[model samples]
Target: MYGKKYLFFISFCILIIVASGCTIGESPAEKMYEHLEQTVSLESGFAEVQEPLIEAEQKEQELFNEMLGLSMKEIDKIKKLADEAIGLADSRGELITKEKESIDSAYEEFKSVNGLVDEIDEDTLKKKANELVETMEKRYKSYDDLHNVYMEALNMDRELYEMMKKEDLAIEDLKSRTEKLNKKYEEVLKSQDAFNNLTDQYNEKKKAFYKEAGFSTTDKKEAS
Candidate 1:
């Protein structure tokens, strides 16, 4: 009878151990780790959303470059390319704006968390998270710069159409618009460089945190 009782006791103890182990699996550290994963995911998604805009911008650039190769007499071709470029910009502009706003909201939500996971209780870790957020915030400036470039293109398109409608187009005006557009593109490039640097830093810091916290930093999209 005592042997049977001992056996039952051993089984009961094993069950309790397993139960506690499962409970312990969901720790503050794990919660924080999950939150960080969410942040990284959102950032990566934003980058993907930007790809279309980047492609469209490149197309617009090619059109602009082609304009430089042609003579002022190729006004019809210039007008057509400008119209196509404008169409591309118009189609993507709203989507980019919407995606940026969505990502901004996600970051805002993350910032609102009283404390993200137990690991963030550490001053250094919290500071790193904050810095990452700041960099993410700074990325908006690139969008602003890009908008300026877009606006310039739109204005140039309007002005060019006006000039093309005339019997005798002013070569000087077309040349001036092209020069101004190129200058604006240069500004956009600079902003893009800054944005890219920040993105690299954001990814590095995110990976470091995930490493320290024992989370899988691999992106799900990439894994697939």
Candidate 2:
């Protein structure tokens, strides 16, 4: 009878141990280990997802800053040209209709560049959280010397157009210069047009870039 009682007590202890663990057939140590392993796996998975996002965001931001620094250098050059044009226009009989049109076109291009540069702070920063602002500043000076040459050409087109229109200039000389001026003028227009188009494309392409990055852009426009 004492043996029977002790056997009952041992069986009860085993039942209690089984009930304390989560599963029917599993031991407490095994279940505890499984729970700990699952916790670590979840933490690892979460980190894996976050790490790439942070890296991609940084890459995208670097590109953006590169682009913006290129833009600000561009803006400064354009501003200088605009100021020169404005000063020249103030002079007597300095600007005519076609020359004025070229000046207007150049001014418009400046405005477009200015607008894009101005949008960099809140809108772009929010979208490109990991971007390096300092990197863009470093890139700005490199593009300046190259971009200045193109800006100079834009100014020359306006100036040459005015020079040839002088009443003192002979028709033969004007005729000869006209072809060359027109060619240079066309090239300048083409470059300015490209810059304008790129700005527009960049704005529209934001949605696509954001979508690819798994961040939803407002309105979520589909990429073509």
Candidate 3:
């Protein structure tokens, strides 16, 4: 009976040690090894070691799912915003080209009228040239103003694109963190399982040792 109690105590203690060592990102078996190395005692060394590793593994998975889901959603939204920006830039380019063509036409007409220098009065020709130049100046100024407006539109689009870039970077960081967590969990889980196997081996050895020593197996077995 006494031997059985001792075996039961040892089994319970081992379970506790393993559970304690196990943490998030760690394997159950790995944690058990750590517990044994740190606190070598019947009461402390064999306590639960698998607890933390198990919890960490679950949390890592949850974080990965959440971050990936949110990032994908945001990527779709940013793509739409980029499309709108490209459209705005294209519209501005068209407007600028039209303004340039109008200016060119007016300048050509003014040159043709001035070329009739011998057929027309000097004063009349001069007046017409001045008017043409003035009209061109007004049109040119209007083009400049419109160009500025278009640029402002482009700037707004750029701001949104930059925001999207920043968001993507954040999502990338989340991915990195999750990956590291996965590695930790792999190691910890491996250790946890190993520790459990070791404990089983120890139990078998203990029983065999008692039997070989001519200890009363029935007495210890009955106690446990």
Best by TM-score: 1
Quote the lDDT for 111 in model 2.
30
Residue-level lDDT of model 2, residues 1-224, one tens digit each, is 00000000000000001122233234322332233223323323222333343343344334323322333336444344434443432331122222234323433332332223333344543343222122222223222322343445435535543543343545455445545644554554454444444433433443332333343334332211
Span of 10 residues, lowest total lDDT, candidate 1: 5-14
Clashes of each: 0, 0, 42
lDDT (10s digit) by residue, model 3, range 1-224? 00000000012222212223224334322332333223223223113322432343244334323333454457665555445544544453444445345434433443443333333334543444344334434433543444444344334434433443454456455445434434443443444344345444444443443333233334232111
Best by lDDT: 1
lDDT of 3 at 214: 31
Local distance difference test scores for all models: 0.51, 0.33, 0.37
What C-alpha lDDT, on a 0 to 100 scale, does residue 183 get in candidate 2?
A: 58
Clashing pairs in 1: none
Check candidate 2 and list the clashing pairs.
none
Between candidates 1 and 2, which one is better according to lDDT? 1
Ranking 1 against 3 by lDDT, winner: 1
Q: Candidate 2, after superposition: displacement of residue 12 in Å? A: 82
Kindly report which residue stretches of model 3 are placed more than 4 angstroms away from their true locations once superposed.
1-75, 115-119, 122-129, 141-145, 152-156, 168-224
